[model samples]
Target: MTFTDDLKKENEDIFQMIFDHPFVQGIGKGELPKEAVEHYIKADFEFLNAFIQVYSLALSKSVNREDMAYFHEQIQFTLYDEVKPHLNFSEYIGVRFEDLQGHPLPPSGDHYIKHMLYHANMGTLAETLGALLPCPWTYLEIGQKLINKYQPTKEHPFYKWMHFYAESGKETEEMRKRLDVLAANSPVDEQNRIKDAFRKSCQLELAFWEMSLTCETWSGELAVIK
Candidate 1:
């Protein structure tokens, strides 16, 4: 198998584990107790908020470099093609970013936006690959579980959104392939930069989750204060 194939396969394995985990199973089936759903929602919100900030930071650091330029383009395409088109209202509700202040998104919606930006700024192709892998993986796994477990009506926003993301399985696989090629062609130093950035991104995600779990409540709109 190609390197990308191997990488995707490994990701799938982990995803499967997550999917089967008791917590995921509960959430997917819409059987999460009120307490569990509350916890999950809060944690997810915080993760997305910080994630977007990291992306913006990466973009700022990218400056005028050629390789970084390409990375930016690829990320933009991915967002346009995959994410923007499939964002569910409930997903947005978790993140209350200023961009949607009038709409009042969830507590953690902005953070999710920042995470996407983070993937765009990863220095090396490999680093980008590591960062980007989670998007398709998380969505695909979650969508499938929701489809199997949840009985949402056609009018439910999440049902339609999840269907769109879930059906893009081929596109997700293609992205992984492209990332592998990008990694192979990137300079060694650039790859290292990507790797470092990926690690930082992961740390940010973890911390965000930790905060969300610890903070029982955050009042006002989740949007950042200017």
Candidate 2:
């Protein structure tokens, strides 16, 4: 079995937790509170900026032209395709882009982005892939499952969101190929590091969902100035 497959099997418990998380179930049921969805979109917007940077770091670290091209393409897609659409959705949901601009990152988002950036900037390519894989891969997995189970209509609140990741889309296929390459070529010594990064990332995915469900924010109260 491939390394990615093995990692998924070993971490099935965490994956199941993420799939069963209230936030995800809410999305599936078309019952997620607007406030919680707003919170999640805002947090995700902040994380995507950092995510783009991680892809850039991967591009810089790429040894071959093909890898560089792929990473660059991913960076573009995250910024233009993913982030832009989410901003539009935010406006649709009554949360302005301005509202998201200065709000502090939720603790879960902060930690997850920091962990991914640390690995993307400082770790080997295989480790970087491990750090990056969970976001898209897990979303795709959840999307497919939700679509199958819910058979949501076009009017469903999260129809577009679920459709975005529902299938083995172009980006998803590209990511799978990248993972296969990494699994085949990465050094034996780095196996443990890769697995650890993947597992921790899956755990963080769960935390992120919980944070959204609870509308978690920074710990201290905000001062009001009039």
lDDT of 1 by residue, 1-226 (tens): 6545555454454555555655545444444343433444444544444444444454555545764664565456554554442234335344432233232234344444454455555343356556655655556756766776776677654566557666767656765676567667878676655555444443443343333334333575342322
Off by over 4 Å in 1: 58-125, 145-161, 167-174, 186-226
Relative to the true structure, candidate 2 reaches a TM of 0.91
- TM-scores for all predictions: 0.52, 0.91
For model 2, which pairs clash?
none
Candidate 2: worst 10 consecutive residues by lDDT? Answer: 217-226
Q: lDDT score, residue 154, model 2?
A: 85
lDDT of 2 by residue, 98-189 (tens): 66655567899999999999998779888988888888888888989999989999888777878877853677667766777776876777
lDDT by candidate, in order shown: 0.50, 0.82
